[model samples]
Target: MSLPVPIDLHVRSYGRVRESDRHAYAQLVLPLDGAVALEIEGRERMLDPLQAAFIAPGATHSQYAEGLNRSFIVDVAPATLDPVVGDRLHERRFAPVGPEARKLVEFMRLLVERGAATPALVAGWAPLLLDTLALDAARPLSRLDALLARVEADPGAPWTAESMARCAGLSPSRLHALFREEHDTTPRAWLLQLRLARVCAWLGAAELPIAELALRAGFSDQSALTRAMRRSLGTTPAEFRRRRRT
Candidate 1:
């Protein structure tokens, strides 16, 4: 008998994250094409098609993707893995992708493609991938959470360095310093990224009209949303929806 699969699978086509959606799952994300940048732990790295990232569950992590970044995400829950693997992965720090890690991603892609197998059987085949990678990750767990939390809380809000710093109880200078140190990007840029993400999420989940989504996502008008959406995600709302349905 095989162990059950511990992941809830969802396929995302073209979208970015909203500032208010800073929720991270314990999982593996492998980009089949394009590139993804993430602030995992406290380090920022860009993942290409050849790379994979293992974000520990409940850890504050955020992702930014460029163009049409197609990927497969393996959502892992701690309860699904063995105690040894779970403990090790949970305690590990954030790190960059490695060659050995890429092999696991390739194996996973193959496993997923071969057939629809039981989660337990799949887990058994890749028992140690998480734990082994955990050993190599640099631990930066505490710094990114609060900022990410603020973003997740309100991606539509007009977030400025001064305003966000006040929200986080830090000075603008301190917030900028910390933001750069942790994510390799400015607070302003992160805010823009989050806004775009919200646009994507709203487009994906809600039935609201384009105008409402544009305003809710902080876009000034329909044209604004159209321009930004095309620049950031490379697709219009109608096109995205059509592709999503098919």
Candidate 2:
């Protein structure tokens, strides 16, 4: 039988809860008003309003809250989270919750208050929330940071400044202006650089063929990948791979 999607959100006033054993699902604890002290994998940290702690599935951890601490406990199936997010969360125990995370937490609060958290809605929001949390944890301090993170996480995705703006909650014009001011380059150019970097990394690490590398690195085809490599790096994928091997 197929497993049910594990996604849940809880908002409550917390008290001192003792340490516990590992759980089967990953957990994220965000304090809205007060703080939570957490020990995950033998490392302890204080989780305040600006911070969140990610407990990996099957990780050993314990947590406690003093007095009346208002918090959000988000539980997600590791398999349900985005691959990059899941990997990153498993890599680290704590991260800062930026404006994007706050926004998501507020949305969850509203849904909980309205008694509108249907199963379908929870499932849909689970991935988005986790993605936002991961992005926030990466210190994406601005709209451009968010946009760049999205592109870097999925170089295979079809990206445009307009679509990126929508993702970053900004107008296309504004995104363009910020890119020019801060990066001195267009969004597409930055994306191309990310893609090329991905290609180069794979070329050095794996023995995959050029066509496979092209598809994996977000190029349309082998020819497209070759053209990009030639234009940007002054070498073809085959030549680059050969040099790396030698």
Candidate 3:
């Protein structure tokens, strides 16, 4: 079962993790080659190829490595995960990669090794790996498919839950309930996911200035976009763009 979400999966590392800071997006550090020293909250540990770290959104964390190290990094949206699984993961800092989860990690590593981690391939694998980490399946399909399509088509629009509810011809509270029932998320969170997905895809698939891309993705400013991306994907826009280009 693959409980997928709007996530950005990249195979890379942040060398010499010093001062600790935190973001609002949950992240997983699954080692693929070497060891990474990771500290979540106040707990410290060394992560090897078979080990992984689950960093809950807004939890203080940092990392460092003495030599060559790269891990399969997953930047996940917490709202998209099963609430129980997400809470359980947040309570724990480290876990041995289970057989099924390791298989997904290995598959990603192999694809990267073969230079086959194209947008389409990565897109398909991203949600699976995210879901596997939480051991959950996908969210239920939304009944408002038409409204969803319109949102996808113009993600940069000034969209609020109220506006979306009006578009769908429902009261705002009713729309919120429907989103929760059908999508397992709120209207605002869903819209954020749509915008973030667009930004990630565009960062990997095209060339544009960060500021320009920010507005085009419905972010109010460059800093706002950066904060949102860092909070949700566990990576800055520059690093994400660099990874795609190189």
- Leading candidate by TM-score: 2
TM-score of each: 0.48, 0.53, 0.48
lDDT of each: 0.61, 0.75, 0.73
Cα lDDT tens digits for candidate 1, 151-224: 54456677678888887778888888888886678888777776776666566566789888888877788788
Candidate 1 vs candidate 3, lDDT winner: 3
Q: Residue by residue across 1-246, what tens digits does model 3's lDDT show?
A: 122545667877667756566777778888766688999989998987545788888889888888787788877776655567667566666765544565566566555654567767766776666556555222222446546645755679899999999898899999999888767899999889778776876777666788888899899998998999889999998998899778
Query: For model 1, what is the alpha-carbon lDDT of residue 207?
Result: 77
lDDT of prediction 1: 0.61
- Identify the runs in model 2 with alpha carbons over 4 angstroms from their true place: 1-5, 140-246
Query: Model 3: how far is 225 from its true place, Å?
Result: 49
Better of 2 and 3 by lDDT: 2
Task: Name the lDDT value of residue 176 in candidate 1.
Answer: 88
**Per-residue C-alpha lDDT of model 2 across residues 1-246, encoded as one tens digit per residue:** 122557877775656767576778888887766677888988999877667888887789888878667777778876776667887876777877665565566566556544566778877876777787777667645556545644654678777778888998899888888889877878788778768777876777667788998887778899998998899999999998788777
List RMSD in Å for every model shown: 13.4, 16.6, 18.0
| C-alpha lDDT (0 to 100) for residue 183 of candidate 3 | 70
